[model samples]
Target chain A: MSVNVIEAGGLGKRYGGTWALRDCSLAIPAGHVAALVGPNGAGKSTLLNLAAGLAEPSAGGVTVLGGRPAGSRAAADGIAFVAQDTPLYKNLPVADMLHLTRNLNRRFDQAYAQGRLAELGIPLKRKAGKLSGGQQAQLALTLALARRPRLLLLDEPVAMLDPVARHDFMAAVLTAMADDGVSVVLSSHALAELERVADYLVLLSRGRVQVAGEVEDLLASHRMLTGPAADAGRYAERPVVHLQRGEAQAHLLVRATPHDPVPPGWEAHPVGLEELALAYLREPGAGALPGPARGRSTQTSEVTR
Target chain B: MDIDKEIRTEGRPGGGDGETAPAGRTGAGSPVEFRLDAASGVPTYLQLVHQVEHALRLGYLKPGDQLPKVRDVVAALAINPNTVLKAYKELETKGLTAGRPGQGTFIQATLSQVTLPELAGLRRSLLGWLASAEAAGLDEDGMVALFSSALRDFFNRRGGSAGGRGTAGGETEGVA
Candidate 1:
């Protein structure tokens, strides 16, 4: 069996008294592409940071390659983390960046890195800042991929890419994954891309995991139904993720089963991962505090003064 | 069971004489079969492309089997209209599938000449994996076991029905 590459257990993070994330648990299976998605301040980046050992969790912990995230040589060498905006030296050329990364990383695959850069027709001497946003993202992606890491963590890796560039980047990612069998966990706002590429999904809202599972399982567990209000309670116990009521017709998002029978007068339709994520985020009491954390935000603000 | 529901009905804008059927399946007198999973990581268009390619490879989709229209796919899959167009456009670019205005897309006359570039891509991918496998301390037996189990799982997921399967191992034949 392929090894489990990454796991987060009851992961939580707080900034001062404000909890950015709370009680999140998920796993990235070996050789699979998992996408983490949510709204602003939803703790996606925070989770990535925690997993990469760049930040410490306040309530729980994570592991990479069966080791703790912090200072574990095996975990550090086996995983590669690509941060947002992909800050790079403005004066550094593409070759320079690769060389620096190679020097710093023991598992770096120099030939593969060079080959990927060549495939994209990027000039070796071109400065990082001189390249367009799409090109920079590509360069960053190339660097991360060249490490030949067992696990890859990317936060908003494609957010800055244009449509064509984004498509190319995704193709490159898939090609690499297919070639190396590397596991990936990419956090992105590109719902369409996630829909097309993600094998597993972890939806975070207000710093908590609303849902996480394989793509097929997640889709099977949620469905969209349109009908009158009289039968609203018919699917009440189906873990209603989201609901909308109209004058004559009401739209309800129900957590479904693959073999669940269609309710009377209501036809079930597949809901995309993007729609399901939004539904989870929009649910009331979804991000509610566990205990006294609700009033602590103001107190923390006062203390910072 | 309702694979034909999403076939497109629109005739090519500039091409004449709308052919109501998908090209690869026309005049074969054999029923065309396709399976599309909405939850697959591969894009729906690519999935459709590969399905048609697989049919061609298997000879089930002869040169002129009158494939379903794009609208039929949209209706059956409940997918957006543009995605179907994109898939058709991609197929047209590859020359394996064609679209004539007023006429729907069809299999190009030379549909079986799988391109050299495609083969080279497959080779490169396999070589890369082999290298990584070696680096990761996996042996030939491990590789064989992994692939074997994966294929077994695939067959099981496909419900163990190898219907209309040809006796010949056609996977490696007639390729560049």
Candidate 2:
């Protein structure tokens, strides 16, 4: 049986009585490239931070590779995280950075680290602060990869890179994943790029997991149905994620089993990843709070504040 | 290994239509590069499958043609390896291709082509009919609608016996 690389059960993180991520429970299988997508302030970074063991959750728990995060030495050894800014010692030379990584992690692959730098034409004597944005991102990825972690979590790693740099970085990541079988969970706003690389998707909205599952399965399950504007309660068999009304028709995004025949007078069409993600993010109260969270839904209620 | 090297060197320089060096190139193992259109509504894996099927129907690929390695496709497209694997698996399920351990994927079945002797005559007649429709001030969309409706009526009149033939036109004609 394939083990889940990361499992969060009712994971919640709060700051000053405001929950950043609440009741976000999802399981990502090992060796899968999972994409964490949401609008800004959707608590994407908070979830990644919790998974990376950088911050403690205010409520509930999360486990990485069968061990609680940020708790045991074994757990630390199994994970590598590259933050959004690709933080590095600004004054340290590239070679010194490599040395620092080797000294810090026992499993650091020195030859691989140096070889990748040389391959990318990154000079060893140059200071980390002087490198280009793309170069810095590559260096950060190389550091994470050299550690040979079983799971890698990256937050917005490509948000700042150019198109070419993004492509090159993703190529390197894919090659590394193929070579080492490292499972990756990356948060990004680039939907098109994510659709290409990610097999699993986790969509967050208002600090909750709006949708989480395999990409193909998700695409197959949810469909866009257009028909006369009428009550949506008739389709109680399927979960309606979003509903929009037009002058003479209503558009609904519902999750249903593949091959299930569409209801009469309703036109069903397949939904793309971009369209699906946007629908969930745009529609307020589309995914109503689960019964248990009704009393604690104050954070999401203050949308404008 | 030698075959892979030959494909890498010769296939890249040959452009899309180079037919030079026909040895080990005519059968199911002929190398064909796959491409993806991100903007297209069709899923990426379905696009790959359609391209292979199109190549087969066009005789660019034949029984025994070897497909590009999954790693090669992943590196070239910057796509998830699972996507490539899924496309290959879909093709396998359709009995169009099969995987051989360490030997890559090979085309297992040939797509049937329209080899009717009277096809040229039928094409000429259809072109004549299209010209008449144009003369009648029918736009492209109108002509398509009329022709598709007529074709559907023709099939329906045939007692719909051809329903399960896997004909592309028959499947799409019912959508409207």
Candidate 3:
């Protein structure tokens, strides 16, 4: 088995009285892009910060590349983080930004950074602060990618980019992933974008894990059951996540088989991560089918050709 | 059975034993149709979902239309399979597509209720955009003007309006 690039055990954090992340345990395999998703204040940022060693966990612990949050130089060099704000020296020219990063990081890929900027047609002499929102994101991402880090934690990296820039940024990420075996954990409300690139998903809500696993397996396990409200009791044995009961019909998010023998009057269809996420956040302890086996065990080959 | 090999085999054309190729084309048209936009705050899968949904709504696809298999889609689009699956799953949840075992995927004949969850997600994304616009010092009027101007520019760049507003019959024929 491959080593886990990121591993959290009983990870928990609290802000004054409220918990930010609690009992959040997840293992991200080496070289995989895992998307951390949830609603606002869902502890996504906290989890990322802890992973980056920017913030310490209040309860359990986090291990990056088989070491502590403040791991050795090797571990630290293997990881790079792009915060949600896309923080950068606004007055610094794009070329200066690249030069600074190259000086600071031993693994920085200066040529890669310069090439990325050229491909995107971003002016090298322009200051980061003066660049458009989309250009700034591209610059920041270029910096991170140039480092050739083993694990990259991006917190809403594209939240500020324009449509065209967003596409370009994602394309860059895909290219990097293809060329190198870097692992990524991105937390964003942009579920659609996350869905497009993330191989795995970690859903957290109110500081606790709601779901985590391969997207395909998760899709296979969860089904949107549509039928009469009266049939709810019949499916008590199946794993259900959220339920919406109308006057005559009922809709349920159930963990089920693709070919499960449905309860009489109940129709089952697969649920996507977006729907599962929405239902998970909207209603807690609502109608979710009970099960600890949230991770899908589908065999997936390496993406490399 | 080797699933990966099976998938690859299905992706190719002209491999069968001298069967008459269907239609006027030599190979399968590009089934994968999606792109990730860095400038847009909306996520990639959401863009794909909305675009695919829009296409379906505009009658670009019909019942029993086959969508590109998830694997083919990711490889062609250079995206994560999870995202395509997510979008496809969303459509499935909405009853817009049906997963027919061993038959790839097909569009459903009718759609069910537009679930509240779908609407809520859209609202959240729009709200995020609005907040950013607000931070950029764009007021309500500025926001409206920006959208209208952007829309006009987009239309102009595309070589003018569909000639006339809301060409209903044209739209019914999948002109959008």
Candidate 4:
């Protein structure tokens, strides 16, 4: 089996007395665009920070780039973390930003960076602080990509951009993946955008890993069932992730395959990625996750070609 | 390769995508450009696959025609490269396209499509119906509502006979 880009075994992080991410475990295999999604304060950033070696785990272990210790040199070389607010020297010209990044990293493609900035029409002399917020985000991403990290981690990279700017940013990220084969793990609360790029999904809720698997598998394993409200409780034997009670009918997100029998009077519909994630996000107690380690082991082949 | 030119038009100054600008491209102009419908609820990759089939069925893409490079599509649509790859792979699996080493993916076979005469005939009939629809004070939304209902009713009654045809026509009047 190929290396999992990230493997977290009982990982947790605490900020003082409160646990930001606890008992979290997931395996994101290489080559797929993995999206880490959750509500605010749901440990989305915490998990990413742990993976990027920016924070020491409060408890348990997290490894990146195929079992390399999170802070190890090998792992650092292969990973680039673009934090929520991409940090750069505000006073530095765009050109100096390139040079500064080049000096800090063991590897930097100066020509690639310069050419890209030129294509974007970003004047090299403009201070990083003078650029628009969207341009600043783009500049940060370019700098990260210039490093050519094997696994790129983005933390809420587009939460602040307008729709067009968001599209442009993601377009750059996608083109990079096509041109460089860079594996990406990006965290975002925006559900609509991820549907296009993210094949692998890791959903966190309230400091725990709620759902982790390939989006396709997760979607296929879950279905929405609609039927009379009175009959909803009778399906207690079935694993229902979220139940919505309507005036006379109830909708249930069940953990079942397409071939699973739909009880009399209930309609079964295939779930979409957004709908499934929302359902799981709404119901924290109804987890679709298996034992993390064993669950991800059988699914390692899904990512690598 | 086609990415640099497109990105330059964004008006937002450049960000590096690490895609080298390949000069002196000799391939003929591409035949189809892809667009996405966010409200359509169709998966992006499936939309791409459907677009390719549409181009094929419309004769815009013929055998040996090259599909857009993955990088170009990513730059154009702001979608995942893997999504494009998946669409191409699906096309390849169905024998509709084949990938040549170092060259872009090419159409391998043509999809069955309507002949010009048939298309013209269908167009005439549809235009005639549309004229009637407009004459009846059915605006665009009204026409859409009526058409979608009729279309749904028609499919709901499929596997039955033309018994469905009369009611579908009858239901169109209700919208008016």
Best by DockQ: 4
Model 4, span B15-52: residue lDDT tens: 22333222121123567666666556788788788878
Mind giving the per-residue lDDT tens digits that candidate 4 earns over A84-133? 99788899999899988999999999989988888888889999999998
DockQ of each: 0.04, 0.25, 0.10, 0.31
> Which 10 consecutive residues of model 4 chain A have the lowest summed lDDT?
A296-305
List model 1 lDDT by residue over A171-209, tens digit each.
Answer: 566656655667788898877657756867777778887
Better of 2 and 4 by DockQ: 4
For each candidate, the alpha-carbon lDDT, in order, equals 0.67, 0.76, 0.68, 0.79
- Model 1: residues >4 Å from true position, as ranges? A68-70, A284-305, B1-50, B53-176
Give lDDT: candidate 3, residue A86.
Answer: 90
Instruction: Point out the worst 10-residue segment of candidate 1 chain A by lDDT.
Output: A289-298
Q: What's the CA error at residue B11 for candidate 2, in Å?
A: 15
lDDT of 3 by residue, A112-165 (tens): 889889988899998899998888887888899888887888998777776555
lDDT of 2 at A49: 89
Alpha-carbon runs more than 4 Å astray in model 2: A230-238, A288-305, B1-30, B112-176
How high a TM-score does candidate 2 get? 0.78
lDDT of 2 by residue, A101-180 (tens): 99998799999999999999999999999999999999999999999988989999898987667866877787777777
Angstrom error at residue B6, model 4: 16
Regions of model 4 farther than 4 Å from truth: A291-305, B1-28, B113-118, B129-176
Better of 1 and 2 by DockQ: 2
Residue ranges of candidate 3 with Cα displaced over 4 Å: A67-71, A286-305, B1-78, B81-176
In candidate 3 the C-alpha lDDT for residue B146 amounts to 92
Chain B TM-score, model 4, reads 0.59
